[model samples]
Target: MFVDLLIGGIFAMSLLPLTTGYCAYSYGRSFWLWFALGVFLPIVSYFILFALILRQQLDHGQRLLTEAKAILAEAEEAERVQREER
Candidate 1:
């Protein structure tokens, strides 16, 4: 059972080349670049793809902060306009 699962997992990993190709295409990058790398280095290519998808913790927090500030600013402006019209 374990060996079967392992084999299946490896087979799924082998298909990363296709996923990488599609991702490259969607991102307007060179599909052949990742495709060839994945074909030649399946394990390394998996890590490469993983790295590409990683988001920095700081960046995520910063984006949330920026969005929150924008929302707050808009609400404040609406409140100020209501006060001025009265």
Candidate 2:
């Protein structure tokens, strides 16, 4: 998980140049100001993104388990019916 987060943060940070460039151009700010924000935002955003992705994965796993249980129940019922007919 830590590795995944780190990888994601690195990828996220790649966009920083565009953001900082825009901020520098539009706001007429110094490189340092835009650079600081550009650096900071991705760390925060990456953490949030990682958490959201992890949450979604867990939810999907739970749903899969529920569906598997439902299918098992149906199969059991079918088997019971087969035995009754026999």
Candidate 3:
């Protein structure tokens, strides 16, 4: 009975890190690093992963904003040229 309980406990402990590694892999991140982090520092690893995802989103938003500003500037320049011609 004691041996069975020990095996079950080990399985339970390993499951979380495995799941975390899989999540990192699915997100195109480093699987082994997350797995090790999850094993040693589960909560911290999750926070770090979330922060990375948020940073990527922020970068994408900044790129889109820059593109929009450039397009608007081009449109304004064209309008100004049209006014001069008139």
Instruction: Indicate which candidate wins on TM-score.
Output: 3
Residue clash pairs of candidate 3: none
Give the alpha carbon lDDT tens digit for every residue of 1-86 in model 3.
99999999989888878887888887678899899998998778878887876776589786687679789999999999999999
**lDDT of model 3, residue 84:** 100
In angstroms, the error of model 3 at 75 is 32
- What's the TM-score of every candidate structure? 0.43, 0.33, 0.59
What ranking emerges by TM-score with the best candidate at the front? 3, 1, 2
Task: Please give the RMSD of candidate 1 to the true structure.
Answer: 9.6
Candidate 2: misplaced stretches above 4 Å?
A: 1-58
| Model 2 worst lDDT run, 10 consecutive residues | 20-29
Per-candidate alpha-carbon RMSD to the true structure: 9.6, 17.2, 11.9
Q: How many backbone clashes does candidate 3 have?
A: 0
The whole-model lDDT of each prediction reads: 0.77, 0.64, 0.84
Cand. 2 Cα-lDDT? 0.64
Residue runs of model 1 more than 4 Å from their true location after superposition: 1-14, 55-86
Candidates 1 and 2, the one with greater lDDT: 1
lDDT of 3 at 73: 100
lDDT of 1 at 49: 67
- The numbered model that scores best in lDDT is 3
Candidate 2 global TM-score: 0.33
